[model samples]
Target: MSDLTFVLAGPVRHGVRLHAQALGRRTRGAPLVNIEDGALPPGPVHLHFTDRIFGRDALDAAERLAALVGTRPLSVTLHDLPQPSDGASFERRRQGYARVVAGARGVQVSSEHERGLLEQVWGACGDGAMPPVAVVPLPVDRPTRWGPPAGAQGSTDGAVVVLGFVYPGKGHAETLAAMASLSTGVPLVAVGAPSDGHEDLLTELEDEAAAQGRSFVCTGYVTDEDLERWTARAAIPVSAHTHISASGSINRWISAARRPIVTPGAYVGELHRRAPWAVTVAADLPAAIGAALHDPTSTWIREAEWDGAALPDTGTAAAMQLAAIEAIGLA
Candidate 1:
């Protein structure tokens, strides 16, 4: 019989589903089972991102799960508890989050920052009787292999690149402005399209790039294979995000290509606490890029040296998660 069973009540195509799939394959000794809806079979149930699955209906489901499980331990791994885009929705989600926090026997978070956020979210409820939280680094699914080697000299030949979804708060405009302000003309390429209503912002960024005689190209969503090719061609990768919590994109990029990265300072304190290979700078973007170009390998990916919290692959991540569940007395 399987010693652990992960209940991913969320959508089948979600990111957590992928993690569960990879973990199931890597785990040893204890057989692992994954199920969708209906009554959870026997054994402990670890609810994954319940809010994402049930949305406003999350509290009711959480309460039901807690009651149905009886004495069997019920734990939760919070993937995201985002404040809804609007006021009414935010209040509803907040209440739902409180209920889950109070009901679960234990909780798991990816980082210290995440734990602190959860405390702030549910601190006032039930006299702050929140479940104990175990911190574990989130797993990243990296490409099987890096594309052909980028030039070792790290010279961009006067071109700047930022890849990923072009959305508000992703620093797309700021990066373009930074590139334009460079003393030398450096073209900028953003390998993504504006999400939904953000199309105008893309036009604005393109115009800004053109005004400065720098070409800005929006590749409009590329496949994994193409992204790898684009990344390998760049002299330096820009891991720019104004706000993020345990970013999968940044982690994957840093792992796949060992080149130096230009990132926001806030990300340094939160994600890469001990990642000296990453260059964290706020403002003065041109200077930061120049520095990264000079020594691209300064902060090269060293999976073995990630603050003793290295999860180089999915298998290692699965082992860590299994150990955490056992630590909480759930397995």
Candidate 2:
């Protein structure tokens, strides 16, 4: 049996799978094992990925997971919690997360903003005692060697680029709208596949692009290699999220591409504190892209900072997880 087990109660998707793979590589000789919907191997500590509880029965599912992992030294991490559309929904989600907190030895959050939000919800739910909490930023792997993807390189030709999975708040429509009004007639390419049940949105966006006379292309989905190549081709990249809590996509873009990004005011504020090269824009998206194009120096500075700095190591991340788990009174 391993000393630690990573429990993936749900499907191993992007962030969850990436973190697990990194941990496996780092925790050699420590006997780290990963399992899904099966008995957890005997271990000193177990960490569960609880970032995908957005269903209608989210609270019930959490309770069931807690019961199944009974009496084990378990910790939980939320990649991104569902944004509550109203007060009632907020309360519902809070109660669900509270149940998870009550069961786990501790909880790990990615950012200070996320920690604050968790605390606020814990307070509102009147959960007796908030569990031990730690702020551990997601591990960013080192940049790989850059190579232009076949045919993808120079395919976009100075067009605006938006990368990552297509979801509701990703601001795809908003980006097309902004493109429609640009005087310079810049092309736009939105790369990546839509989430389940969101395929229609892509069709709508295509029709809207035609109606508005904006040159738009949807690459559906591309490999990581292609993503990097496409990103390098972008004249200016846009993060245009309507509401962003924690974005792995943004982190990868900034760290790898080292290019200037045009994002909303909130990201601009957040990144400026850490990465000053990020530019913020108002409601007018075209103007912001134009501004970013004019100041490529800022992007260069941002990129230079990343090139000089090293990303957090997986071994360090494993050490931090172990410390947090042990702090909760687990052996």
Candidate 3:
């Protein structure tokens, strides 16, 4: 059997899913099982982002599906927990997982922030029942520079790109506002799946950009090539995750594209303090972004060499979670 099977129950073709697969592959052939929405499994790690939209029936179904995985040292891991959208189902998902994993020791949350989220999730458990939730900081592949080739003039072009699952809370509007204040006519690239909430907001953004004579592109959903395309072309990538633990896309873009980043103080913000390439805008995201955009190459040379290996090459994050489960079982 593989070290762990990471079964993701979602639209399996997305960026997060793909990164999980790549990460799984790197983690000793740990299987990244692609199951339908409710079809879950007991494995070292489970990529669960449960929401009320999936409903109680689906949530209950997921619990049973996990039970069917036969209790082989499970570490049910929820990514981006306290899922920004739903609090109830997120509770159900974690509660259901506690039943499967039983002791707190087997349950592992991927992002450090998830530990508190799990505590809140356990409050829904009532009558005292909670699991041990250890947050393994998500590992990002080392960034590779995708900037211009040797003779490309666009290498010096000024642009600030924000890559993520775009929506109201994602701060797209704020990013645009930041660009307006910058001296350079900043080109902003908004990438990721645009939620319904951002639909009209996006149109307004494009119209404003056209009116202002600024350059902008919004790739609704980016494939792998598109991912590299946006990052390589960007001078700075804006990350304003309102409610998230950690973002795989952010890490991948950071590594593969190697641009300096303007990020909100999310889970692993501390690590960025040590790395020159990253700067956090905890209190004022837009203004922070403006600063970065105005000087994308500010500490370019210095930041270029800065790397925390904050995200190291862990073969499979799932495998590590699995190994933790196995150790738990022995105890």
lDDT of each: 0.62, 0.62, 0.57
What's the CA RMSD for each of the models?
4.6, 3.7, 4.5
* Candidate 3 displacement at residue 109 in angstroms: 2.0
TM-score of each: 0.74, 0.82, 0.74
Per-residue C-alpha lDDT of model 2 across residues 36-62, encoded as one tens digit per residue: 445666544555455353344558766
- lDDT rank, highest first? 2, 1, 3
Off by over 4 Å in 3: 1-4, 29-32, 37-73, 83-105, 124-129, 146-148, 151-157, 196-198, 207-215, 257-259, 266-268, 273-277, 280-290, 299-309, 314-319
Most TM-score-accurate candidate: 2
- What does candidate 2 score in Cα RMSD to the true structure? 3.7
Candidate 3 lDDT, tens digit per residue, 181-237? 565466777877676455777787788777667877787777778777666666666
- Candidate number that wins on TM-score, 1 or 2: 2
Residue lDDT tens for model 1, 13-92: 45566566666667665544544345657777665664645543656655655665566567777765544332455565
Model 3 misses residue 204 by how many Å?
4.1
Q: Give me the runs in candidate 2 sitting further than 4 Å from their true place.
A: 29-34, 51-56, 85-89, 142-157, 183-185, 260-262, 265-268, 278-284, 294-303, 307-315, 329-331
